[model samples]
Target: KAVICETPLGCFGQTICYDLRFPHLYRKLSQAGAQILVVPAAFTKKTGEAHWHVLNRARAIENGAFVVAPCAVGKVEGGGESYGYSLIINPWGEILADAGSDSGLINANIDLEEVNSARMRIPSLRHDKSFQF
Candidate 1:
């Protein structure tokens, strides 16, 4: 799912958990003018342990957009375990906050200007070229 939110700052895009695995989706959202990406996930313990933080950071760094992932903590209805490392990552791949297995909020003072700064430093988005396999 994609959500385009027009906040006081700029356009923010929201994607569901599984959508985080798709980079192209985030790129499309960025091309359509998304500066921040929010991912709400109930990432499984198994996969999350191996890929959660890295994926979220990679997405933010590569797209030059802030990544805010709010993950579900503790056991679910079906006895499924969720990796609760909810994170707030900056455009530069910096971890602003991490909620590690706790039931609480992780706050970060995000500066929208950093998005532009990161993009300016490495303009990968503008450099993308489509090629056929």
Candidate 2:
């Protein structure tokens, strides 16, 4: 299930690490009027390297919402290392900030208005159709 919280910044959609793989969750959040989707993840280095950026970008592009992903870095307690490439992407799927493989704070100036702008430009959300086979 997807949860949404209203904040001073905008309506934020929350999801944890592995949940990022599911697109339906993001669509639910976006349809519920989320302007920003927040993903706090501790993804394995291998999987992160392969799918992190692309998945995050796809979520932002498809939903016309900003994606704020803060990923863990360094070795985990049990074993393997965590990938640390935190990213702040806009609704247009442009990466505004990246925290490259290190534990540090990354910031980006986000304009909430851009959410509306991107949605207006591509209006895919308004065109959604459901069919069963």
- Top-TM-score candidate index: 2
Candidate 1, 91: how far from true, in Å? 0.6
Return the TM-score for candidate 2, rounded to 2 decimals.
0.97
Q: For each candidate in the order shown, give its overall lDDT on alpha carbons.
A: 0.91, 0.95
Top candidate when judged by lDDT against the true structure? 2
Which stretches in model 1 have alpha-carbon errors above 4 Å?
A: none
**Lowest summed lDDT over 10 consecutive residues: which window, candidate 1?**
1-10
lDDT tens digits by residue: candidate 1, 23-108? 99998887777899999999988999999999999999998999999999889896988999999999999999999988799999
Score every model by TM-score: 0.96, 0.97
Compose the digit string of candidate 2's lDDT tens values, residues 96-131. Answer: 999999999999998999999999999988987788
